[model samples]
Target: MSQHRKIYLASKSPRRRELLRQVGIDFEVLLLRDAPPRGPEVTEIVLPGELPEAYVARVTQEKAQAAWDAVLARRLFTLPVLAADTTVVIAQEILGKPANRDEAISMLSKLAGNTHQVLTSIAIKYQHQLLQCTQKSEVTFAPLSDSQIAAYCDSAEPYDKAGGYGIQGMAARFISHINGSYSGIMGLPLYETTDLLARLDPH
Candidate 1:
């Protein structure tokens, strides 16, 4: 097996890209333009009765598999593919990316003065082998006023993030504390990710 100095990132998220670059990992963003278009089945739709951890891991694995197929189709370098997914859960109910400002406001309203679980599942695949893991974080929010929620909804960040918030963004003011990996809340768990790479590398 050939060792890969650079891996293929299967996400377009700038946060994930920055996280990898910040750690000095050389990676190329896999462009779906050349890959076969995906259907809604490949999307992050939570299944009925699916727990947060299960949902996140399933989504990450799905993404990694799709990216691997794309890499083969594009005949790109024989590099491993990395993919990840993050979601928020409160009272066992998943709160995904809000569709509109109204929904963002609603999600934030429910999260005020509440603690929720943030799960980020990551997957890396090379040939027939696949390595996967999940990072779970508990984030507590300060009591928020309606005005604060509305003000945040007006901004453009919430729509693209799960639980209608980003821990590393302006939403940091809303978070009182986090009990687990901070990077995991941002969508990728840096420690777990680096560890996976080190273990997967055949050097």
Candidate 2:
């Protein structure tokens, strides 16, 4: 069998690294110091009342393109670069990383005893070719008391996670059920990500 293609991951998320390792893909971290400032694209389609799926896909694509540009500018490794973005949605509202403890608690309160969708979009870019995919998972949470929310917020786990919870961390107890890819909910969808890489490698 041929060797798998060397790859690069353009992210700082530990969860993404763990997921990629779980699939046995040989890769290196692609860190870009001058990467374009990350943010939502300002477009007519991203205005208020826009669909979450479309918005997230656009964001991921933008991130991938930005990383690709950075790689070219810096003369980094010439390999497939992967980038992704994950967001949590509840009743049409997108819940991104919490800015502060109070915001995290508020997000958790809204998610309590309710089902929300987690959307993760991944992009792979090599040379001039690009491929993108998205995975959505529905997660239901148990009713959380104020104390539970406060404790979790104080633990430093929710501060960096979307939806104010880390499914694989201390917040696992709060999840009652999940209706889709667990890995996707964690930040990176393993199957989809690996499949995309396979297409690029074809070995």
Candidate 3:
């Protein structure tokens, strides 16, 4: 809960950084050397019959492990590395970030008037110990009109986030209900994150 014990956050997500900052957890962003391709993203393809939970957990572990190795490779000293991965699933299908305006509109259209799952998996590695957990939240979206979808897509917020929307952004207007951790839906679950850090002190 103090800045005295800082960790390295292995992510570029502003939302995750802000969440950690708000909770008084001091952290520095850790980037892979030469901007290497994220292990999961390098494939951009999920395995056959892989469930949402498995996919997210695997990605989080890969990210955390990669960061840990990077710390040694870069000789960045001995600090814990925290990483997370979030994904959206509807009707058993994973909704990825849209590559074009059309896909964004499609993702939003399917999410409207439906309940979808947002799963975020967090991983923390310190020395030889590694800890990981997953948070699953169901988000119910209100029925949206074509104009509303178009307006949101035009805002350009759907291009970089999973499931084509950020709950903390304008997309909040489209959410009717959420049955899980808000912070988890945003990107990071503070309760789980704090617990992991306490159990495995970053020092």
Residues 40-121, candidate 1: write the lDDT tens digits: 4267778888888899999999989988998898888778899999989999999999999999999999899999999999
Worst 10 residues of 1 by lDDT: 32-41
Worst 10 residues of 3 by lDDT: 34-43
Count steric clashes of candidate 2.
0
- Distance from true location, Cα of 108 in model 2, Å: 0.3
lDDT of each: 0.89, 0.84, 0.89
Stretches of model 2 off by over 4 angstroms after superposition: 1-4, 33-47, 201-203
- The sequence of per-residue lDDT tens digits that candidate 2 reaches over residues 57-151 is 88778777877887888888677888888889999999988989999999999999999999999999877779899999999999999999999
Candidate 3 per-residue C-alpha lDDT over 1-203 given as tens digits, one digit per residue, 9 for 90 to 100: 34337899999899999999899898999975433453332234688999989999988888898899889988897688999989999998998789999999999999999999999999998888899999999999999999999999999799989999999999999999999999999999999999888787434
| Cα error of candidate 2 at position 114, Å | 0.2
Q: Is candidate 1 or candidate 2 better by lDDT?
A: 1
**Each prediction's RMSD to truth:** 2.4, 3.2, 2.4
The 10-residue segment of model 2 with minimum total lDDT is 38-47
